[model samples]
Target: MSTYSSNQEQFMYQTIIKWITDDRWMMDILRNVRSLSLPDSWVCAGFVRSKIWDQLHQIEPRTPLTDIDVVYYDATDLDKKTEKVWEQQLSRIQPELPWSVKNEARMHIVNGIAPYDSTVDAISYFPETATALGVRLDEQDQLILVAPCGLTDVFEMNIRVNPHFLQGRGDMETYTQRIQQKNWQHTWDRLTVVDS
Candidate 1:
């Protein structure tokens, strides 16, 4: 028996799929990113967050993205410099695209936390559960979603900090600062921001 995503999750995933299919650039970017075949890789974070938020806001599908974050996990090589190499390669593939590559293996040191076992594990540490989502294209050219925190907050346009980030006082402060700085409400006025 093949288990499937919940109906709501399937709806959300279909929305993303339609949006990406409608845009040539988005499909091209995913294809290029997948070409690299980095270990356990996914184009995650705002790439997924902004799209869902944009759809909820009922705005044009043309939300300006600051960076396209490509996160991967490779235990054998934890060298930070390798991420830069990946960035350069992506830049060459699409000069106009804003690409940010990160390796989850060494990110624990940068984040001052224990090592993350995989890309999904690192995504869970993201400040907001809504933001802790990822998507990628598999070898079959099918879209695959890896949302560790589920799709509830994002689908509801709720901006609440993730419980994981609440453990550290510093993390809480950083999350607050990020909420203020992002000011997503300015753009998506309908958003329900719960700042704790």
Candidate 2:
């Protein structure tokens, strides 16, 4: 259950949207992804999380993203090659940007879980609640945000394991390794990491 009320979630959603809108670079990335027109696609994970964390920390300049993660659901065409093709397309649009494209429909095979229902479903299963976020631009160029686990954790700078990870859908060792490797607290000093 979410600790935040619906109003709080809505407020945070609006806050995030406003932040992204103010960021020309982020808006451009969203625009580039929208051009692909992939079914149920969004730039997710650290791409969104890092932005919020950086904002919350009041970092002077934006933290450079290691890569822009683009995820879409296309059960009809689960070809992994399609992801690479999309990456190539995005690269042509912004060659300097590091882009990673993935078809969530086929990611289940890699994650050792039953097929995900949609891109949002796949996001909910991400290792950490803070990372289970996504955003995209709609036809009207309006920003849309999705956080299946809600916004409380991210807003509070809490890095807790997702419920799916706790339910045996994912393993602890992998989660632990990710937490250790990410060491997000080093970047966002206010963050509190909860492995268990």
Candidate 3:
């Protein structure tokens, strides 16, 4: 089974409305993509967190959403020039939104990179691909939500999200061990332990 359900978006909408006011921001962030002719989706894994909350957080009330995860699946069969055009266009667009960049706690993707960062160059630092229910917009402007599609969302585009950066060393065995040893909520405890 997938991590999300396309039909369950309403559940996501209702659950996070108190904090995110999601649709409004989605429409705004996507305005430029719509102008340049790209298709995208404002998906929430936390939406899945909605039903699973009682078992995890011990309450079903609103959780402070971390970020607005948007994945744009463009269908333009992009050549290098076409990709560059869209990338530059999007770079000019991100700042217009109110999302925070501190550790990418505001808005980001799971597959693609920041518009100014190239896949060939940035991939060394992050990976890019389509996300679950992987779908993108066609040149005609339609939302195709499916799985194993063209590209995953840009979860790596998040600012300073290198899961291992704080560790002064290049070895991530400790970090990987941390993730393996803990739950998602406390995944960053090692960093916070330093701050405390």
The C-alpha TM-scores of every prediction are: 0.91, 0.95, 0.32
Each candidate's number of clashing pairs is 0, 0, 19
lDDT ranking, best first: 2, 1, 3
lDDT of 3 at 3: 34
What are the lDDT scores of the predictions, listed in order?
A: 0.82, 0.90, 0.33
lDDT of candidate 3 over 96-194, digit per residue (tens) = 432311112111243233431221112123211211222223445444333221111222111122322222222355444643453443422222121
Cα lDDT tens digits, model 2, 1-196, are 2433578887898899999999999999999999999999999999999999999999969888899999999999988889999999999999999999999999989877788899998898888999999999999989988988889899999999998756637777878888999988888999998655
Query: Which candidate has the highest lDDT of all?
Result: 2
Question: What digit string (tens of lDDT, one per residue) describes model 1 on residues 73-183?
Answer: 998888988999999999998989889999999888887877888888888878887888888888888887776777778888889888876652236777788889999
Return the TM-score for candidate 1, rounded to 2 decimals: 0.91
Candidate 1 local Cα displacement, residue 89, angstroms: 0.6
lDDT of 3 at 26: 41
Arranged by TM-score with the best first, the candidates are 2, 1, 3
